[model samples]
Target: MAHAYVTFRIRLARHALADFIASFKSSGEIVVLVFGQVLIGLFALIAMPPMAASALPFYQSIPLLLAHGMAMSLPLFLLRRRVLPRDVVLAMHPLPIPPRIALAADALVAGILAGPLALAYIVSAAIWMSQGPEWLQADRALPATVFSFLVTCGCSSAILHLRARGPRPGPRLRRLTTLALGEPWRGPRIAYLWHRLFWLPFWRGDNVIGHQQSALLLGAIASAVAWTMAPAGIMGGVLDLTASASLILLADRGDKAVREQLGVLRPIMAAWPLQRRALEMCARAFSLAPVALLLALLFGAGLWQHTAGHVYLTLAMLAPVLLVAIPRFNPRARVGLVVASIVILTAVGSEIWN
Candidate 1:
């Protein structure tokens, strides 16, 4: 039974890899993305952390590196949630595979897609952990797989549970979201209306701050951990990535409402007297309200302490936003511009912090 399970997992992973490759055959950018990511991971592994931290006691390095690895990999899995109708998609053009088994396989494949990211996290940390007190040995490989497998299983199980519910959410969900956010505006000045949009998509009865409370606590914990265990430059980059990710989640949660409103209210918006610059500012404000406040707090704290390179590090955090805001910045360009930019910027910021 155990052997069968192991084989099942490997086969599922293979299917995911094949599917990913086939899906991207018409667009070669996926190959560039994969390769660029590998290069970035390599750079991060070698470039982060101080030379002294690199030589710390084995026990000290292990805990910090382990925490760092978990911090990176676990949050990635959280973002993989999607509304795909796994059952219907697979069933439409039926593979000969049995329904019970195939759906399970699909769930596993969905999770396995994130395996490379999880693998990078641990391998990068392990390299760092090995830097201090001891050279890495070959005999400890089995234990590493067990640790990484736990994260994979957690991701797989969450996706499988979501699949078992139904084929995506229906109109009832749309109705509930409509009730939560309230009716869309007909027409209004951008500045006058922009602030309301933050908590506008929230649950109807709950206080505006209720949902943000958990995120606030998590950010606090993350900051405390980073201050203690991570270098300043790296912490800034991490916070930047975290901020970008947080905004992405915020957008994801309200995507349907945003799209629905855009569809219904386009004519109204087009008729508004707001200038192009004001509209663009409102767009940025709507997207970045939550993160902007946190960034302000961090900058304030950094200023009070006269933290060196704080300005540079703070600017580095804005780089990821370019991925979303800039339409022409293709990450998979022949020269790998975006990947190189991130690696170099992250490294230089860390060096300054160090």
Candidate 2:
């Protein structure tokens, strides 16, 4: 039973990554961009701490490296959360698998999902050790680093277990959602219904910070940076572009949800008196409001920053919007288009800066 469960989870994780990769396969540039983005992110994860610690004494670097490893637990937990759905655990509830076996399988799966990050730590530690640290000092630090990695794995496993078995919002939360949507439903019934069924859970559920809240926070931070630093260097240009891309991507979360629901409800919705285009426009207006607000914030920040990079930043930010707006273009294609725009814009901005 344990072996079977583990096999199931491994397949599940593989499928998730496969699907995400497949989403970018239409364009070679996008495929390259997706893989490159992931590789660079993981490389940064592996290299940054050791690079920072290289200048410090072995003793000092030990704490720094250990702290960085501990900090990585959050990503591990998020990886597990992404790959391992709660429904899987719920499905296993009726099985004859023992509690210990179930948890063991979960821990193993979490470790596998985060294997790249763990491998990064291992590589980082090896590089750190090569940098003229005394054998005794290295020996002492190695055990602690190993312990920290173990603890990080343990934390992710615990989070996975808890999240899978965790209590959901119950009857009261449902009642609150209905109330918020209105007793008789406000605005277009289709829009209100989507909000009640899908969006509200993320907004008012156990997770306080949903997609919209995250976007707002991101916008605030980017705006604050623009207002304060108004950074003009090549690095700043690249950062501004990255921030703009992130804002659009975050805003797309809700938009994607709406798109998915609309797809599912198309036949039923077509039966209504409203024209199909009108129905789509109404649902989209309800969904795309967050995207619009985020774009406004991003543009406002670019103007306020008033750096040489501002013009390029604004242009790059608009690329995704223009690409996604073309009739018959898949709205979901924005993810790849946004990343590609960032790369092209950053390269151009760098050359111009030079």
Candidate 3:
């Protein structure tokens, strides 16, 4: 029976792989991935000198490289569906394969897709390192390269898992939003508060605003472990911790926003009921109102800071929220207006900031 099951799983995996490939055949996602690899390769070739100069102590540089690698991989993982929903779309079709097998196949395909880019990055890093000062050449580029790959894999895995397991916004947002707006503010205050507080860790965890609470705590613990072996700068440790925390917080916020937006459109969701939709609407409203208030506060804070960088970042972040709010003013003009605003704002912001 065990042997039979093993054979069955193999067949299922093969079947899943076939489906996965077929799904991507016409998607043009692979073309985009190839183009991106080429662009990165070109950029690396041009920027080799600066990149080499940026290298630090092996210990310090390793984490920095890993962090950068993870950051680079993150957006691709996060926006994978925008290219092709190959995994979800393929999984939806009726097949003898189990969901787990299908998921594994999807992962395998994604790994294959990422392999070229990973190779290019490694080559680029090696070339860059070779151009650095002779003393720095002693730094083990192989270990750093391996670390970067590991970071990319870890981040990609985490993002995929989160995407698979995170709360489905369509149902949750529709239900929550409907409840908040349909009923008076007094109704279910405790429930509403609980929901609000649930995402607070994610908000407070944001790195941009400098609240790296979780990352700092983890890094401090790691630093204490490292200190047992050698001395580490307290300031450097704090900054690393903060950066890690901010990265996590920012990722969480981005995912939460996407989920909430999905909820707003839940009314059009074929599988959900009116009651669920109503509740989701309530949740969406509740989530969005505070976000707007937060943006206003951020705008004020940015003005107070009087730094062009902060002002530009604040504006970049708030542009989306403002675009989201446009529907309220004129529901019919929402989509076009939002798209236009985003284009104009992004173009202007990039020109000014860059």
Candidate achieving the largest TM-score:
2
Clash count for candidate 1 is 0
Clashes of each: 0, 0, 18
TM-score per candidate, chains pooled: 0.42, 0.70, 0.36
TM-score of 2: 0.70
For each candidate, what is the lDDT?
Answer: 0.46, 0.59, 0.45
- Over the stretch 258-339, how does candidate 1's per-residue lDDT look in tens digits? 3333455457667766574465445544544444554555555453243444644454345435433553433245125444
Candidates 1 and 2 compared: the better one by lDDT is: 2
* Highest lDDT scorer: 2
Better of 2 and 3 by TM-score: 2
Q: Which ten residues in a row are the worst by lDDT in model 1?
A: 201-210
Q: Who is ahead in TM-score, 1 or 3?
A: 1
lDDT score for candidate 2 against the true structure: 0.59
